[model samples]
Target: MVQNIKTNLPGQGDEDRKIRERMAKIKHKILVISGKGGVGKSTFAANLAYAFVADGDSAGILDIDIHGPSQGRITGIEGLQMTINPDNSIKPIEKGGVRIVTMASLLQDSDQPVIWRGPLKMKAIKQFLGDIDWGELDWLVIDSPPGTGDEPLSAVQLLPEMDGSVIITQPQDLSLLDARKTVKFSQTIGVKVLGIVENMSGFICPHCGKRTDIFKSGGGKKAAEEMKVPFLGSIPIEPAIMESGEMGKPFVWMFPDAESSKIMKEIAGKIRAELEK
Candidate 1:
């Protein structure tokens, strides 16, 4: 869970200046968000960071899922703790091509619950943005909590210059509904909708190399077309992704040639191209 920010809240004017000062050093800030939970959002964010890293760019990840911080584990920095620098800024934990900060890493125990109200949650997220020493980075990937609620909204509000948001969903109607809601939320908030990534669109059988659309397919493509957003690409559900995540190793690195890894790499490239454009 997030640290206590209620007592140490900053003055509004000063904090805004500090936040802009900090963000000025970062080039691109992209948020990976979903309308519903359990859609592999964190995983996508992690691998995307790794993809940028693999491309020789400096990247950082701000895992803003206050209640359910999974980027710590996904980025293989689960047990790591943030330290203080000479300037008293909280140092983000470094691993792979990404430096990371997550509420889970601050917990003394893994099972601890972060029971916080809206104000407190907002304060903590602000601190993560204004207080962390992100230094000069090519990309800052924010893994936001599900829904159009406080956490995700706070990230959008805090980073006014954020590049865009990537919506994630599975190939199912229920998931597509949430995905559409997310797209609308981004549009309503006036943030750019970079594109949509259809995760878990199908399952690839390891033994036979055969593909199965267990969740039914093309829903994400259809939804994106209807919504007039660019459809980034589809990532199939492979056993390797699950296995690697459980082992605290990002699959894109562990299985560089795997089908899903290639898909994620392509998506990352597309995002870079969009940012360039």
Candidate 2:
């Protein structure tokens, strides 16, 4: 059950303690971050959450992308919306048995925008952590906005016990360069780099069934090797992925037998193994 966020109620001190205790019971907290945008970080987070739930585990995806919230879309639950409970805490919407929280759900309308600065971002992150009752989740997948900016930093600081961070990047030189900066930022903050994910490594021509290096693949693997971080594998670019995202369905869920789905599941397995170790 989702708990409501209460305002100026009696016994507020005791209620706060209960919330903290509930949060402490969660097993794993993972942040999916990227230094550059358009690299499919939200998609990765959503599919990973779906895979976990599909396997009978309870998971949630929290979108800390204040300026560009899209996890609800990736999960195919866009426009459904969330509601604030009597306690004043916002309840996360559930889809396919996976609990999700995003700025999109909190918006007054689809066209609304979140225009805020550093302190505001920090406060929102804190509210999502301290006020909301997330219950006991096996995994909490947080999709952060691009770069090692205020949002990502705030999330890390709020959850001091985060298991690690997964960095997403493309197969382009420029993207790899920025991704390196993300790796360094994580290291500086004492967060482990679980691995690097290469999104859009190649594109498959529908008619030819041939793989083309649209963005010049292998850069991410090379970067991972040079940085001494594990390589989680690559996700090939497919037009179907975009179509699926638009239609409110993840490619992995829509076509679990497709090549892209296979890769995503493999990456999820690697993440699971790393967390276990």
Each candidate's number of clashing pairs is 0, 6
The C-alpha lDDT values of all candidates are: 0.86, 0.82
State model 2's lDDT. Answer: 0.82
List TM-scores for all candidates, in order: 0.94, 0.90
Q: What is candidate 1's local distance difference test score?
A: 0.86
Q: Write the per-residue lDDT of candidate 2 for residues 122-165, one digit (tens) a residue.
A: 87877777667687899899999988888877777666677889
Runs of candidate 1 with Cα error greater than 4 angstroms are 1-12
Report the alpha-carbon TM-score of model 2 versus the true structure: 0.90
Worst 10 residues of 1 by lDDT: 1-10
